[model samples]
Target: MLEVGSTLPEVSFGYIKDGKMTDPRTNEIFGDKRVVVFAVPGAFTPTCSQAHLPGYVALADKIKAKGVDTIVCLSVNDAYVMDAWGKASNAEEIMMLADGNGFFTKSIGMDMNTSDFGGTRSVRYSMLVEDGEVVKIFVEDPGRFEVSDAETMLKNL
Candidate 1:
């Protein structure tokens, strides 16, 4: 698992931004920026939809006020699903990123799969990264949610 103070892995994946397909690495999305990146097992899942993304949306202003540049919500789904979920959840302040192949999640050593889910997915995790280095992490236990809430992340900031 990636630990605090570790340099974040160099990973990139496709995502939908403003209805356009984008590659984050090519865009240098995290370079020289203070970022809050959170991942969930899947898009539109119950806890992730009701709590995780909304928590970040509700705290978007406050997070920006604290000097954070972006709050990103990543999932193992494709860009279309991520875009749809963002629209449905009204996650205006959060950038919904798609790690379609679990590349980013696996690079960070946070990929897992539940017995029932039957596929590799990102564990519920949140990290505060500064210039591509991790400053803090909040990783939820498998099958558990809530520890990585935006409120807690804001408090940490």
Candidate 2:
């Protein structure tokens, strides 16, 4: 899995803006910036919707106060789903990034197969990336939401 000092892979996210598909390059979004990226297994899942993303949304101001330029919530779902979730969750302070095919998660070795969940998905994790390099990474254990919470990250920051 990616860790402190690892450079993020070149991944592209598919987004829909004005009824057109937009694939923004990873570097274009994170390059030369202090970005906080948190990953969840799914967009509408209980833990993710109830806590993970919401925690970040609530603390976005504080996080940015620490010099974070961007706050990204990335999932393996499509752009439409991600966008919808963002609106419902009041995530104006966060950027919703779609990894439609799990390319980004797999490339970073953060992919997992939870048979109970019925398919491949990303492991819940968050990272502090500065200038395209990882400086802090919080990876949650299976079925747990401990180290990866926003409060912990904010404290660390």
Candidate 3:
């Protein structure tokens, strides 16, 4: 796993803005900014939909108030699915990023082979990045959601 002080890997995550798909460079997103990146194993799954994402949604303002320039919620799903989820969850503050190809996840050494669940996916984790460098990271154990919750990250911040 990428540790604290490591520079974020160069990758592009699909972004859906104004119903148009765009590829946003990871470095540009994190450049000279304090950003929070949270990865989920899959979107709309039980723990993810009911708890994980909501925790962040509930605390988005608080996290940003602590100097976070942006908050990103990442999953292996594509741009369209992510857009629908962002709307369904009312997560206007979070930039739902689609790592459809898992390139970013693999680069960070967080990719998991969840072929049984359909395909490759990222493990649940979160990192606090400042100016494109990681300052803090929390990776959850399989089938768990403890340390990476928004409340936990907020406390750290």
Candidate 4:
């Protein structure tokens, strides 16, 4: 798996903004920006919906205050789902990115599958990327949720 200090993989993915579909890489979204990218297994799942994403949402301001250019939530789901979940969670400060085909997740070596769930999904992880290079990583153990919280990442900032 890609680790802290590794250069983040180059990949393009879709996101819904203002009800329109957009591509981040081609749009040059984070090319010169310092971004916080967090990935969850799926959208609207229990831990992800209730805890993982909310932590980032709650600390979005603090993270941005520390010079972060943006906070992004990535998941191996479609853009529509991400958009809906972002709205439902009240995550206005975070860009919910959709890795619909798992291409981005696989490129980072963080793709996995739960037998019960039945398909490829991103492992629970968080990264601080600056101009496309990973500066820090917080990868949680499978089914474990302690290491990748926003508070920890904030402290690292």
Clashes of 2: 0
In candidate 2, what are the lDDT values of residues 27-104, reduced to their tens digit?
988899999999999999999999999999999999999999999999888999988999899998888889999899
Cα lDDT tens digits for candidate 3, 38-71: 9998888888899988999999999999999999
The best candidate in terms of TM-score: 3
Q: Give, for candidate 4, the lowest lDDT window spanning 10 residues.
A: 22-31
Rank by lDDT, highest first.
Answer: 3, 2, 4, 1
Off by over 4 Å in 3: none
Listed in order, each prediction's TM-score against the native is 0.94, 0.95, 0.98, 0.95
The C-alpha stretches of model 4 lying farther than 4 A from their native spots are: none
**Candidate 3 vs. true structure, TM-score:** 0.98
TM-score result, candidate 1: 0.94
Writing each residue's lDDT as its tens digit, candidate 1 over 7-39 gives: 876778777877899878713767799999989
- What lDDT would each prediction earn against the true structure? 0.87, 0.90, 0.92, 0.89
Higher-ranked by lDDT: 1 or 2: 2
Candidates 2 and 3, the one with greater TM-score: 3
